[model samples]
Structures are given as C-alpha cells and as structure tokens.
Target: MHVQLGVLGPVAAWDARGGVVGLRGPMHRAVLARLVVARRRVVPVTRLVEDLWEEPPADAVSAIRTFVAALRRALEPDRPPRARPRLLVTEGPGYALKAAEDSVDAWRFEHAVRAAGELPPAEAVRRLTEALSWWRGPAYADVPEAPWVRSERSRLIDVECRAVEGRAEAYLSLGASAEAVPALDAYVSEHPWRENAWHLLALALYRSGRQTDALSVVRRARRTLSDQVGIEPGPRLRRLETDLLRQADHLDPGPGGPAAQVWAQATAAYERAVPSDTRTRLESTAGLMRDLAVTGGGGLEAARRHRVAAVAAAEQLGDPEVTARVIGIYDVPAVWTRCDDEEQARWLVAAAERTLRTLPPDGHDAARCRLLATIAVESRGALPTDRPASGGQARALQAAGQAEQLARRLDDTSLLAFALNGVFMQSFQRAGLSPRRDAIGAETIAVAQRGGLVTYEVLGHLVRLQSRCAVSDFAGADRHAAAADRLAERYDLPLVTVFTTWYRALRTAMTQPPADAAAAYRQADAILDGAGMPGLRHGLLPLAELSVRLRHGLVPALDAQDDWGPYESWVRPLLLVEAGDTQAARDALRDIASPPRDLMFEAMWCLVARAATMTGDRDVMRRAATQLRPAAAELAGAQSGLLTFGPVAHHLQGLTAAGW
Candidate 1:
C-alpha cells in the first residue's frame, strides 16, 4: 500500500494513485499534522489537548476522540468499522501516526541527508537534492500557530539547514565550487554563527580562485563568533585560516574533512562484518524463550532472557521495528507477576512504560506491548480482594481503553481481546457483578473466537464463568467452566485448566459434597505442583476457597508442600477455628494484619471473633467486634456482587446483637 502523508506542504494524505484523502475538517488536519511531527512517538493527551485548544474546552477529551476517529476513517477509507488502523493509533494516554519513513517527506528528508553523509559526492548531491525537493514552503504549512506545531517547525528548519550544508559539501567535493559558493553564502546569511557554514563558504571561494574573498569570509566568521558568544573561531576555522594564508596546494581537505570522513565511514561499515548466523541465532533465542514460557517452569524468566537477546540483535541490526517485536512478547507480564512486592511491580511498570515510549508510536508490537504493560501495572490494584481501590487502577483502565481502540484500528483481535481483558478486570474490581461485566465478557469472547486465539478464548470463557459465579448462577457458571476446561485441554494450557478446576471446586464446595470439592481442589493442586505463584493474586482464590471449606489436615494433604507461605497462612487459621483449636486459631490470626475498613481484614476478623467467642476469650472478642463493626459497615455500603458478601457483615451484626 503506497500510503503517503504530506506535511512538508499542506497537511494532506494520499493513496498510491495520487488522489487526495479527505481529512474531514481543519481540526482533523491539525491533529494529523501534530501526530506526524512526533514521528511515531506517542504524544500524550495533555500535549495534544494543549495544541488543539488555546484556552481548552471542558469536553476536550471527547472532542479529541471524535476528531481522531474521523481522521482515522479518512486515512483508511477502506477499513471496516473496527479494522486495525494502518496510519494513526492511540498509545497510552495519547495518539501516534504511522507511515513508511519514505512516505513522510520530513522523515524521508532526514534519512536521505544522513545517508548522504557516507556516500560519494555525486550520489550525495543527488540524494540531498531529492530530499530538499520534498519541502514545499514550511514544515506543516497548513497547521495553525500552536506551540507543538511551532516547536516541530523549528526542528524541521534546523534539519533543513543541515541538509543545505550537506548539499554544499557534496557540491564542493564534486568540484562545483561556483554552485557550492552561492549555496554556502545563502546558508551562512541565514545562520551567521554556523562555523561549518562559514568554513565551507571559505573553502568554496578559495577553490573558485578568489583567495581574497575566502580570507574575508574567515574574518567575518571571527567577528560573528566573538560578538555572539564572546569566543573566537574554533580549531577547524583557525586551521582553515592558516591553510588559506599559506596558499598551499596541500589544502588536503584537512583531517576529518567531508570527502575523507565519508570514505572512512564507508570503510568502517564494510569492515564491521556481522556473524553469518546472527539473525538466525536471535530468532532461535526468541523461539526458545517462547517455548520455555509455554512448556518450561521458568515462565517469564525465559521470556526475559529472550527479550534481552532479541533487543540486542535488533540494535545490532539497527532495526527499531525488530526491537519493538522482541520487547512486545505476550509473556512480558510474566516478569511483572514475578515481582516480590508492589514496589518491585511499580518499578517493572515504570521500566515497561519507558520502553514503550521508545517504541515506534503506531507500531503493532509497541501498541500491543503498551497494553500488556498497562494491564500488568493495573493488576497490582485490581486484585479481586484488594481494598481501598488502588489509585493507579483508574489510570490503567483508561490506558487499556486507549489500547483497545488502537487494537481495533490495527485489526489485531488478539491485542483487542487482551486489552478488553484489562478493561473487564478493572470493571470487575470496581463494580463486581454488573451488566457491564456480562457485556464485556460476551464481547471479549466474540473477539477471541474471531481472532482464533485459544488462550484468550479460554480467558474470555473464564471471565463469563466468574461473572456467573458472582451472581450465584451456578448452572451458568458450570456451563462456562466446562467450556473453559475443554478449551484449556485442547490448547494444552495447564494454567487455564488449573483455573477452571479451581472454579469448579468453588462452585461445588457450597452446594455438593465436601469430598467432591476437595477432589477438585486436589486436581488443581496436582496441575500447579508448587510453582507459578508470582504474587498474591495468582493462586490466592483457589487456596483461600479450599482452606475456608476443608479442615486443616485436608488443606495440607491437598498440596505437596506443607509450608505454603501466604497461601497456607491465610487459610490455616480458618481451618484451625473449624477444627475447634480456638487458641491455635487465635495465635494463627495474630500475625494477619487487620487494616481498618479493609475487606480481607474484616472477613478474617469475623472468623477470629467467632473463634474467640467459642473459647471464652472476651478481650479478643471485644477487639474483633470493634474492628469488624466499621469494616462490615464499609463493606455493606460498598458491597459488590462479585465475591461472597454478607458473611462478615452478618457475623458482626450477630455479635453486636448478642451484646458481645
């Protein structure tokens, strides 16, 4: 597809046939121009808003979203309603534009100029001329006088200046002294203190048989340098003056002169031979890492090793596109999960964000990676049982929404499903069992199926199962659980199978025989063995549910390990209380931190209170009642249909009424 966006002249988009694309309106054009100037790096929403609005509107975000949507349609007229966009995309809290480096005139110009530096004089002159021809009048000529546009305009002008100087050098190298003279003269007139421009001008004049003119040019440079910055001309200029004075035939172009420098660079490039199997080895490394992620116990560690090697290979090859792909591995989150604490999680998130910032703005890998990183960061706050709703969680949801919009434009259903998973997880955390959750689950399932992503398909079904279970729809939950089980087995995803088995156990625990539920829990444990709990969230629910229902002996017997730190810690007390070991249960609960108004703390305190009452521990009972009362009140007010509600609140109420 020969898609070209012209910001060098008017802000215009064109197809291969040279037909103009309707950017919709002036506002839309401005937005496209702004994104193009960013050269594929993400532009934050706040920056865009500032550019699009002088005073800023109350509904700035809605208006920008509308403008970007229209611009997207204009850019890709043939795209279906939700097709992945090729030109423009949302990244994090902002938007980015994507096109071939040669398709955008400014990028084409910069690349050409850079390439010209290593070429012979004739080729360099031709390339520079072609690059300069891309400019019409000014950079983003049609855009209004916004700060972003002006800033980019200044940068482009500097690039233009560099191109002009390069062109002069190429002309001088080719013995076109007359042509070089005028070009350098014009350039120096505009950028008076550019020492290279003056030096080139002097060299051109001297070569044109005007030694006196060349000497005068050096004098002018000395004055300009002294006046502007209170410094004399540097070593190059001083050396040039000495050569001109001697009128030496051995001008020699000096050390590191343009012609000599170009030849040296070309020589170095030729000598820097890469290993024959470098690309193959990099691919092998990435493939092995991916293999370990799926089949080996190393999980994300293998993936991380692959990322480092892949990125190194890409950097060696000087391919940003390859670097992005290497970093965008779906297993990126596995690293975040392995973080031992929230601080570590936050550090990982910050690092991921930095990496995402460096990725090409609208790159598929970058967009997918941003979504994954956002989801990982947000996961810290959206754990099913966390209290006080993490401050970063809302920001994560917003980022996921942006990623979803971009994924749809890119026509990437897997990324769309992953992004939607983040949205659903956030919504579940906030509202629990709402119609929104049902709708999100259904939509994600459809996306996964359409995308033919079995992993996501399993995840989508699991979400539906969770939502159904939240509403106590055991039959519906069972159906979804069965679907998940079949998909997990078919896909050979042991983790998915474990989740499904755990869900089945939770469903049967409250309704069926204890033995049947214990068997199901045991199946999940056998699948998990002792590995893959990177954090509190991964295996918490299954362990908590099993410990809550079964006796202490049964809890340990279900797993291979007798010492399951946090997992055993949370459930062991409940088992002790149930087994009538009240003192032991009380001792077990002592280390469990009961933060005020926390749901987990309240739930645990209810059990502690009940055990205290049975053991005639009045002091412990009074403290538990005091802690449970406010926590229960808070939970009642913020009751989500997501988890088992009323148990803690009912315990607190029962205790209060009994005058404990």
Candidate 2:
C-alpha cells in the first residue's frame, strides 16, 4: 500500500486509493508532525516524549511507542502483523518516517521553489504557482503545539510568502505588470512590512500608466513602514519611488515588435560576449550608457558601474562627439541644493572639459553647446563652495551663459531648453533672485512647449512654483503647483508631484494652525523620505517645526545631530535660547556675521531676530529688522527650495513688539 504524507496544512496521510488515513488520536498526529518537521531524520523516543508533554508521565516512553505504532498502521494499512514497517520504521532508540521527499507535500513544494529559480520566468511562474497551491492553510494545523512544530511551521509559512513573491516577480518579468498588480496588492495587504511587495506593486502600477496611483502606493508604503515597522523603507523601494517620479522609460513595460526583439537579442548578446572588436565594445558601452541615464535598470550604483565602462569605451574610441554624448547623459535627476555624488559630478565636469578641448575652440555646434551645458550643471555639485561669481557657481553660470547663447544662435529649441536648466540651477544659488529665476522659468516653459519637451515643461512649472512661493505669491504659486501636478499626472511624471506636495504643505502651514501645518509637513516629508530625497529636506523639516513652535511660544526638543548645513550657525542661537541658555544664546547671536546673501538670507536673519528677542539682544534684533524690512511682505525661508518658515512680516512684527 502506497502512502502520501502532508505537513503543509495538517499532519495527515492518504493511502494510494486516495482515502484519508485515520490516525488514532491527537497525540498520534502530533508525533507525525514532529517527525515530518525533522525531514526524515530520526526523532528519539525520549525527545518525542519530552516534546509531547510538559511533564512526561512514568510510561511516557511507552506512550510514544504506542502512538508511533498507530501512525505506522494508518500509513500502511495493508501491512501484515509482525512485519517491519516500511514507511514509519523504528530504528535504534528512535523513529524516522522513511518516505520519499516527493510523497510529502511540504517537501515537494520546497523542491519546486528551488527548481523554479533556474527556469525561465514563465516556467518559474507556473512552477511557483503550483508550489504555492500545496499550502491549504497553516502548516501542521492539526498538530499539538510543540517547539519543533512551531519552528518548522513558521519556516514553511515564510517559504510560502517567498513563493508568492517569486511568482509575482516572474509575472512582472514577462511584461504582465497589470496581472502582477492584484496579487502584489493582496500580498502587501497581508504582509504590510514586506518592502519588496510594495516595490513591485508600485512598479506594476507605474507600468500600467497609473503614475499618480503608483506614487500614492509609495507614500502608503512609507507610512506603513514607519508606523508598523518603525523603520524607513529600504534603498530599493526608495529608488523605485524616485524612478516612478521621474517617469523613467525603463520602468515602462518592455516593447513588443520585431525590431525591439532584435535589439533586445543584440543587447543580450553584447552583454554576454567579450569586447574583441571596436563595434562590439561600442555597442556594449552604448547599452550601458542608456542604462546609466535612468534608474531601475539595476539601480544607481549599478548605473555608475555602467558609466565607468561607457566612459572608458568612449575615451578609447577617441571621438569627441561620442565622448561628449557618453559624458553628458544626465537624465538622472540631481538635488539642486547640494551635491549628492561629488566624485561623479566632478568626473562628468572633467570629462566634458576634456571632450570640449578635443573639439575646435571656435566651433559653435550642438556637441560643443551640449558639452558646455553639461559642465554648467555638473559644476554646481562638483565645486567646493556655494559662493556666487566665483568657484563653482561662477564656472557654472559662465558655461550656462555660453550654452544658452550658442543655443539661441543655432535656434535649437531642445538645446535651448537644456541650456536654460543650467542657467536656472546656478541662478538659484542666491536669495532675492526669485524674480530673475521666475523669468528663466517662464522662458523654459515657452521653449519646452515649443519643442514638445514634456519633462522640461514640468520642471519649468515647478521652478515657477518655487519662485512664486519665495515671493509670497501663494495665489500664483497655487496656479503653478496645479499646472505642474496636472502635467505630471498627464505625462506619468510622478517626481514632479513630490515638489508640488512640499509646496502644498508649505502653503498649508502659512494659513493653518501649527499642528495642522506640522501634519502636512510630515506627510510631505514622508513622500520625500519615500523618494530618497534627503538632500532636499536635510535640516528643513526640523527647522520648519522649530520655527513654527517658536512662533507660537512653544519650546522644541531639538537634536544636535540634525544637519542644518549653512543655516546651523544662524539657527543655533534659537535652539540655545529655547534650552534656557540665555547668556550663551546672546553670545552666539553677537558672534554671528552679517547674513550670507544666499537663498536663505531672509529666513536665517529671521531666526537670528527670533533668538535675539528671546535673549533680549536689542542690537542684533535691530540689525535683523533693518535687513528684513525690505522683504517684509515675503515669506521667510520659502526661497530655500524645499522648506519655509512663516511670513517675514510676522517676524518683523515680533521684533518691533520686542522693542528691537
């Protein structure tokens, strides 16, 4: 008589005729579960007795033997009396279930999962789906609670989750993103802490052209992680959020066509082959370059590796245009406030400069224009300081100006849009320049619209939104924000919504109570955090919270490790005063130099004024008032990109009331 065993759901056996075997009692089933948990290894009679009872009875050893005898009879019903048990054999001092792994459902499921890894995505999906079907409910559901049974059940459940995820991933690899979405959504709902499920669901949503929904899913993931897991989402999920926002083409489903198939095959062949010829090397490098231009194609770190290989190949080819093309692929979005990857930025700048030298000095062609624009953007991050008209900013502005000029002369709309981006980046370095930046933004929007540059157009709207916020034109800012969001959703550009969300939060803070505003900021911060945009909010969130609290005469518990960057010195005195160090706060206020004429000047001065008021430093308060008086109508800190304090008018009123 053939026997089939199962530990996947309940501990049970079926005879070859498909009849359920009736084990004598609960203890019999528990013994079978414990042995199956051991995976055919011997479970000593003494150990079985100890596990089955909290305190074994005097005849516990005999009881275990009796249970095993009943299990053996149920497993092989036709066995003759006094014949040795084939399925459940008694060995020296122990028992082992001598069943083939294929006869046990859990073992067969695990084997199928292992084998699926080596198969094609379609085959893997089929194998895993079948493997997953083996699970009817919790493993060993009918067995008594034993330590070994619990551990094995937990392991089986985890493996079942993996199989579900594996099948979903296989569906995704087969370009069935829409099909993957429902399963992933259900999986994440059941296992909310599974970051990979969230990542795949967001990707599937984005690929299905639900860009806004994809971003919402990411935000939900962030909140779920923070609330339930007490940790941020991992880098892969964050990277996926970033990629979704940018509408990276690679995140879209793979194309279908004869030409696309041929190209895919070529790329695969190039990846597999050694670069023995220049053509092969060029093809390989070009493929890598394309991957480097976006996230989600093995992520930013992998793309950086691709950049290295592409640059080497381009340099070897010794073609200035090719070299410039390889070096100037800046589709990866950068933080405008600071350099995230200084080494890579510097390499780009150096490579562009070298490529420019190879071209004729007097040439005013597209390649030269593009190379200069590349230097302009990369130099902002590559340079050591943020000082204007010198160092990085100066070089960046000069190159951008040249690029813009050449682009106009050539009448290349796309080139003009590209050059204007550089112009906007460098020009945004200083405060009181929002008017100029606004004009640049307008011109970019016009140029981009004419050239059908959807991404640049969205960028222009964001630029305008920031400028409007800086100038305290909330009405205008609202219009720009709406426009940007509309374009973002329409074009599947999710990243644009991140900035607009921050602007909305800031706008909310301007009108709502502090707590309400704080909640909005937290929401925005969650979205920013989900997108892995730490640079944009470095010290901004905490500073905003502190400023709002101080405005309401509330003291904040500040952390010293918060990276306030250049604003640290200006904001330190306020923190000190709040901590009851009035004398130290006054001293710190006295030591501060005139506010740097950068984007945060008015905001930083307001912080100084607030601190001065708290410490009764009339002189410092008067100095801040005199400087901020001209911009009394503007919002403090709004010009600082992703953060804002309240109105300068309000701060100035406080300074006056404090007798400054």
Candidate 3:
C-alpha cells in the first residue's frame, strides 16, 4: 500500500485509502515529523531525545518507545502482532522513515525544482508552478520549533524562493512578462532580500510598459539591499538599471510588434469577400504572415491553420502559379539536418506534383521550374523508406537540376537564384560537401545582389557562414556572419539571429572549456526557443553539450540506452567506452555499418575514432581516419547546421597516435 506525507504545510500523513493516520497529541506529531524530516536516513535515539525536549524525565527513553509504538499502530493498523513496520523501520541505533520521495510533498517540490532547471523556459514555468502549488502554508507548521526543524524549515523556504524566482525568469524568457508581474509583485513584497527576484520584478514591469514603476522597484531594491544586506545591487541588476535608463533595444520584449501588425493585416485581407484570383493571392499572403508569426514567437497551431486554408484555396482556384506559391511558402534557407514537419513536407510535395501535372509540359516553363524547385526544397531530410526506386536524394537533385536548367534558359535572375537555392538544399546532404556549398553560396550572393533581393542576399550570406564554419574557416565565417547580420538588421528579418546565435555558440563549444561551451549553448537555445524555432535546435543542443564533455574526457550525465535517432548508433559505442567496457565498446563499433555519406557522416566518424582509440581497435581507427580525411579541415558535425565535434584534424591526429 502507498503512503502520503506532507511537510509543505502542517505535518501530516495519510494511508493508501486516504485515511489520516491519527498522529495524536503534540509530542506524537512531533515524533512523526522529526522522522519525516530525516528523509529516510537513520536518526539516532539520543539525537531525537535532545531534539524533542530541552529537559528529559527519568523515563524519557521509555516515553519515546511508547510514542513509537503508538505511531506504528496508528500508521499500520493491518499489521499482525510482532510484525515489523514497513514505513518506519529501526536501523542500527536509530529509526528511519522509508517513504518514497514522490509520496512526500516537500521532496516532490524539490524534485520538480531540480527538474525545472534542466528544461526549456515554457516547460520550466509549468514545472515550477506545479511545485509551488504543493505549498499550502508554512512548512512544518504543526511541529514544535526545534533546532533541526527550524533548519529544515529554513531550507524549504529557500527552495521555495528559488522556485518562485525560477518561474518568473521562465516567464520573462518566454516573453510573458505581463503574466509574471503580479506573482513577482507578491513574491518581492514577501521576500525583499532576494536580489534576483527584485531584478526580475523590475524587468517584468518594464517589459509590461510600466517604466516608472520599474524604476521605482529598482530604486527600492537598491535601498533594501543597502539597508538589509549592507551591499550594492549585483552586476545583473546594475546592468538592467542602466539599460532601463538608456532604453536599450535588447530590453524590449521581442521584435514581434511589427510582424504582428503585418500578420493582422494579411489575416483581415484573406477573410474578406474578393475575386477568386485576388482571394488566392490574399490567401498566399496570409500564409506568409503565418510563417512570420511562427518565427516571431506566435502560436504554431494558428500558423498551421493558415497554411491548410491557403493550400486548399489555391488548389480549388485551379491556378498553377497560386498553387506553387502556396506550396513554396517556406522561403527561408533550407539548413535543417532533420525533417521537422514530415506531414507538412509531404503535403506540399504532393500539391506541387499535382499542380505540375495540370500544367502543359511544353509551355509554362516558369511554373514547372517553380514547382520542381518546391519539390526539391520540400523533399529535404526525407527518409529512404519514404522514397521511390530513384531514392529521395536522387529525386530531389534531379528536380533541382531541371529547375536550374529551366531558370537559365528563361534568363531570369530571381528565378535562377530560387533554383540555385533548391540545388544547394539537395547538394548539402553529405560531409566533404562544404566546398560545393561554398561555391553555391557565392553564386547565390552574386545573383541576389544583381536582382536586389534582400531576403536572398541574407540567405546567401547565411549559407556561406554555415559552409565556412564547417570548414573551420572562422575568419571567413565571421565575415559572412557579419554580412548576414547587416542585411538582416537593415531588412528587419525576424528570426535570422537564430542561426547566427547557434553558429556563435557552436564556435564557442569548439574553442572553449566544456562548462563555458555548455553555457553558450544554453544561451543560444534560449534565443532559439524564444524565437519559436524549436524544431531547429530540438535534441541537438543536449547532444552537442554531451559531445563537448566527451571530447574533454568527461562522462556526460545522459542515459546511454536512450534513443537519440540517427545519433544513437555511434553515441552508444562511445558511451560504452566511457563506461570502461572496452570489449562491449569494440563489439558495438564492429556491428556499426559504414557511416552513411550523409550530413552526420563526419560527426559519426569522429565518435567512432574516439571509441576506437579507447578500445585500441587499430582497424577501426584506420577506417575512421580514412573516412574523415576528406573533411580534415572541417569541424565534424558543423555541416549539419546543428552542432559540432570540435575539429576533424584533432580526431585524425588522435587516430594517428593510436596506431592507425
């Protein structure tokens, strides 16, 4: 049977059937509470005796034994005579309470706080909110204020403060600053000594457009810290105050205000009564707004609804151009290594194919080219099982090639740039393709500049940045990153910083210590999450951090048995080596097939090289070195636009030194 204990409020216990255990009198409750606070650790009788009373009677030990017997009878009424207690057991010279952590409200609250620390902001808010709910009143309220009880109560209060501040921080991170204000107001009033709470409250108020109130809060915090703690405000609070005074753009909630207005206008236009052709165009424009909304931290479900409506309207209109526009709405550069939305991609691919069938083969070459390019872009990251006999990559490349050929025949610069982007998306499927991608990026920039396409210009720079990073050309990468940032800022692009921020973090992870690298990755992830680009960084950040730790000879705190998709096959072998299971690591490495010549090939090879080195598998080392030699100048895994495994040169040197 299960047991439930509560210390977040008054000390209490309930059995499996929801009946109170009838802990009688102040002394009885105190004894049960003391055992509960021990958290299943043995507390010696002598310590309990001292904690329970300042003065002891001659029969105090017998009195404690009587209390224990009465508590056991009340807690376990079904136990047979002389049977041992399951929840409370005597161990050595003390008694221990053996309740599960989840059964105790205080323990569960602490667990949630710890778990919230590892999660993204939105999830962290939910976890911390639920944990805070477990506190009904003051902790251990019914117990007498013994020293141990007082200490435990103080610790719980500290944890509660952290949970409150953590929730507010998460809300701020998610741009729900207004929602965080009321709670933080109450929290700061109750716990004025917490500088972080004061900072968050002030920031939340400022973000909610209460600048005067925010300034007052900061000033009040300065006074409170000076008077209460005899110190100045911390660096973060000081910086926040300066930024507030200057009205820094970074202090603004998000850059979504303008995008939100555009979205509203497009949405209104699409819903009006209009001609079929105009309506189709309006629907397509609305679809673009939906994409903007998603990239600007708006809800995903609304974007999906807009997409579906636009696709249906275009198809019903029977206009191939409108259909193509709706199908190719995702105009960003295709840099994702994994398929984010399979259903959406499949739908767009099928729509493009159907529209192509409707157009005459000889004429409408531009429409055909656009449709072919859409197919190429949407066909990215498709699994082999989803392809026909020609294979997914082959099919995508064929479409891209045909589109580029048609664009050149038409002598249209914009169309050619679009077609080249399709080709780049398909061509970037494998490692050692960085040189090819670099050439493509260069041509894209030239063509976009000739046509004055700002969006495409930014994309061109981003592509070059990614390719340069892959090749470990940090100087060249920085140039392209600067170029892209300039264009993105001038054009007011909403989510361009997501890619740039990730690249910066990836570069840091390659060059910095593991802890610093992890922090950089986390900062980048927060930006990505706040931009509503979860699919771009999903599962990749943690793996990136793990790779950094592993490279530094530190064992990562990850479950090796957990499935990591394509990363599982290689990571498992490396994890085995970390576990000191040389034979197991060797066997796992042997079972791994030749690394597929895909985006992850070099990264997987680097992991295999490390495992091989640790296991002294000279044959595997030789194979890994041979496979990784072509990309020796590249950072392994950076080509995937996600993460990196430092440099391929490092792995090659390791392989050579390991007798490869």
Candidate 4:
C-alpha cells in the first residue's frame, strides 16, 4: 500500500522499497505527470487532450479514456474493473490523482521549500535539500513538449532555484562560504540578468576572504546589466559595492574565536623552555590543523598555503603520528576540490607514503597514511571513460584493497566506507551492472551511518545514485540524490556539491527535450568551470546523444582539441548529421575507431546505426547493427544498470527491425 509518484524527472511511481509501478507507456506516464502537477484538482478533458497531442485525432478523447483506465489499473491493481477509482477519481470534466499530499514527490518538495524560510539556518538547509532531492530531472521529463508542460516546467525550475538560494544562504550563515561559491557563481553566470544571485556571489566571495574577487563580481554584474539591459546597478547591489570598497566588517564571518582558543593551547604546549612533551605538542598541532582544514578551502591559493605550512610543520616534528594525521586531514579537500590538479594530489600521497615507511607497518599512523594515499589514487583515476587504458586504475584498486585491510585492523567504519567506495567506483567501469556494486553501496551507507560520518554518507548516497541511474531507475535515483544533497551541504563537501550539479544536468538531458536539456547542461558546466575543475568529458556526452536521438543539430560548441576520443568522436558525426550533411557524417564514421569496451558504446552505436540508416549507407548500418547486438542483448537482460542501456538498445533494435 506504499505509493510514491515522482514528476520532477520522468513520470514514475514506486513502492516503498523502490519497486517501480508500471504505467505501461509514455502516454500513460505523461497523463500521470500532468495530473500530479495539478495537485488533485481536475484537469479538464479538453485541456488534457491539448496537452497530450499536438494534433489530436477524431478519437483523441476516446484514446485518453483508454489511457486513464489503464493508468487506474496500474495505480491500484486490486480495484475491480467497474468500481470507481480512488487515486484517479473521475471529476466533473476530467480526472484527478487523489492520492495523499506526501505520496507525490513534487508536492512534498514544494511544501518543504515553502516551509524552509521560517526555519533556523540548519533546519532550512535540511528542508531545502530534501525538497531538491525529489527532483530527478526536468519537470515532467518523459512527457512530450506542449504549452501546459512547458509552462509547468518553467514554474518548477523557478521553485527549484528558490530552494538552491535558501541552501546557499544557510551555508553562508554557518561560515560555509566556500561551499556556497560554486552554486552561486554558476547561478549568476547562467542568469546574469538576476541581480540577486550576483549579490549572493559577492557576499560569499568576500566572506571567504577574497575581497578582490568580490569586487570583480560586482563589476561584472554592473557591466553586464548595463550593457545588456541598459540599466545601472540595482540599488541593493550598489550599496553592496560601497560596503566592499570600505572593507565592511559585517561582510565576513566574525573572527574564529574557537580557532584562536585552539591556537592558544598549541602555542602554550610548544613555548615551554624545558623539552616539551611530544604527545602534547602532537595533539595540539593536530587540533590546530583541524581548524585550519575547516577554514582553509574558502580559496584555492589560501588552501595551498595552509597545506604547505602544515607539511613543513609535520616534517619538522618528524612524528609519524602527527604527520599521518596532518596528511589525512589536509590532503582530502585539496585533491577533492581541485579536479584539474592530479600531480599535486600524487605528491601529497607520495609524501604521506614516505612518512608511512618510517612508522611500523601495522601501526595506527601507518594505517591512516594508507587510507589517505588510497583515496588520492582513486581520485587520480576517477574518470574511467576519459582514459580507458591508464595504469592508474589498476594501482587504485590495489591501493583500495590494501586500505580495506588496514581499515579492518583499525576497526574504523569511516575508513572502511571510503575504501569500499573506491572499489565500487572502479568496479563498474568495464561492465554494465553487478550485485557486488549494490552490496558495496549498502555496506558503505551502513558503516557511515553507524559512525555518524556525513562525508562517507554522502559518498554512499552517490554510489547508490549512480547505480540507480545506471539502471535507469530515475525515481529511486531521485530519492538517493536528496540525501546526498542534504549531507554534502551539512558537511560543506564542495566536490560532492559539484557532483550533484553535474548529475542534475545529466538527468535533464536524458529526460527533457533538446532545448531545455542544453540550458541545463550549460548551467552545470558553468558551475564546474567556475570551480576551477577540469571539464568532464562525460558531461558533454548527453547533448551529443540528444542531437542524434532527436535528428537535429543541437550540439554544444566544442574546442578543436575535443574533436577526437571514444566519446567525442561519436559526437562528431552527430553534429554533421544535424547540419544536413548525412553523407559527411557517414564518411566521418569511416575514420573513427570502433567503440571502446563499455555499455556507453551501446548508446553510441545505436546513434551510429540510426545515422547510417538515414544516410542510406546500408553497409555501415548493417555493421553498426551487428556491433550493437551483443551489447543490446546483455543490457536487455541486465537488472542492475538496465535503465542506462534500455532506452538506447530499444531504439537501435527498433531501427534495425524497420530495415536498413
């Protein structure tokens, strides 16, 4: 009797434990998305007809009646055939989804967001994140584009942004200014016309001690607003600029009294004339390092300086315990946030490993060093599709295995969760799905929750989210995504925040129409670029898939260097096909290499087969169909990652079945 209808992404329903309630087809799902958005009010039959069909047939009303009847059966299977429906009750002119308010994720999200403003900072963040998590993708993603759907999508996006603003403001109030920067920067970049986002970005930068950057933000806002709209800065923004010029004390968090108190204890322990107790100094330095780690990542250069100072202090003390703790606490954010910087991560890991050699192999300090180095190696090889043959992945798995053993000996749940996360990320690179991946994710979540570790809990949710998306359970993915957002914000995990935005863009492209999908992609990419992270190759793949799927030229502008690769190469022909050069697209495919050993190849090959069919290249069409068969077969039977592959495989099979 557990019912959950989700319209934030694809129109889907799920039981309490994530079992999907089949709505039979896109038409039925579309009807449900519309009804859920109506919030129990009846959508008139004429309006439903216009929403469902661009050009209705003579029997459009009759067709809708059939869809509704089937949907009622799907929603309440035990209901008698002739009995009045409870969930999809017939109203005066049309139908309504008369379920409880909380049974619909969209309604629950709206209620949570509306309630967030009156709550405390912590509670506001929690509520806002919960509201956001219900959004799997674009509003009514699987539905065909029509006036009503488009209008509702716009309203939902505006509400979603409100939740984002609330979360960012909450983080700023809690001194998590660095975590607020990427989300606000991306928002203002996408919506330069919105002066409120500009103000928020400036405040975040100034609070993070980047006064010059804050000034640059206001300047950009004034220029853009003036040049585009022919208006001066808004009064609120002008006042903020004036405050920035005067170095207003209220702009930043008050000086950290707790940090200063910790520093005082460290200094007292170190300044004694007699030889200081080694353990006391080590503990004091660790405390000081913890505070710095919390406060440091507000800016990259600032974080680097703090890390350098800590490394020097650890080396001078030459205490493996202190050095291991220093490496463990300091290096994670540096590696996690700076996605483009692998060499620095490797250097930190090597330094930690060298320190480990000076300690006993089975000691706690050595185990801590092992855990640090393992995660760094995993980060260095995190993007498997970007470089398939790199030895870094093999080394990463070896390190993860080693770390897992160490974590067991230390009896540390957080360390064990991270060690397992590494394994889970790398294991799925060459295959579609596996039970072990789910087990790893569940165990990671369990261990992390028992230890009260928010960071590991975020990682666990990501694993579940990725696995769910891989199999195409958009509704289940939405559920996990909400938890990820809440935890990442609570702990101020910037990299996790980046991942959530990217995942959102990916879902948007998968579910929404091309134009809407492109805008979402641009927003997520801007967030990544503003954070100084390297471009994600996978992030661009969705737009390419859409261009091919929709038979239109909707490609994002790519640099010349992005013209080749397993991912980009497939995308190249898609652009050509969109530009009305099907012949050139076929020729381009001739020179490109066969797809790599991955299920994403199924998506690429399906598009290739469709493109070949369109260009009348029977030979290429046959070859692509041949190459796609095993991939489609394996994915068709695959239970875990079925969602990712199912849509593409079906399309390819349908095209092939239609004859070259």
Give the best candidate by lDDT: 3
lDDT (tens digit, per residue) of candidate 4 on 153-242? 888888888888888888776667788899788877767777888898999899888999999999999999988878998899999999
User: Which portions of model 4 miss their true places by more than 4 Å?
Assistant: 1-325, 330-339, 348-390, 489-497, 505-511, 535-570, 573-648, 651-660
Arrange candidates, best lDDT first: 3, 2, 4, 1
Q: Report clash pairs, candidate 4.
A: 133-482, 471-641, 471-642, 471-643, 472-643
Between 3 and 4, whose lDDT is larger?
3
Off by over 4 Å in 1: 1-292, 296-322, 331-348, 360-395, 409-411, 428-436, 530-564, 567-660
**TM-score, per-candidate, Cα-based:** 0.43, 0.58, 0.58, 0.47
Model 1: per-residue Cα lDDT over 1-660, one tens digit each: 467888887888888899988887788888888888788888888888887888988998888899999987777788888767766776678888766566887887777676667555665677788888888887788788977788888888888888888888778766677788876888787788789999989988988889999999999999987887688999999999999999977554532477665865664574465444566446545655655454322343335455555656655675545544554444321211123345544644554455566666664554454435455433543333234444665556566677667767767776677667656645533322334666767887898789787766766676666656544566887787788778767766555655565665565555556576557556655555323344424544454444435322243333222334433544566567666677888787664544222223444455556556555556666777765554443332112211232345666765666567
In terms of lDDT, the poorest run of 10 residues in model 4 is: 636-645
Sort the predicted structures by TM-score, highest score first. Answer: 3, 2, 4, 1
Give the Cα lDDT of each candidate: 0.62, 0.75, 0.77, 0.64
**Residue 170, model 3, lDDT:** 82
Candidate 4: C-alpha lDDT: 0.64
lDDT of 2: 0.75
lDDT by residue for model 2 over 556-636, one digit each (tens)? 767543557546788889889888989889889875776545456778888888899888898888888877886776778
lDDT of 4 at 186: 82
Candidate 2: C-alpha RMSD to true structure equals 20.0
Worst 10 residues of 2 by lDDT: 292-301
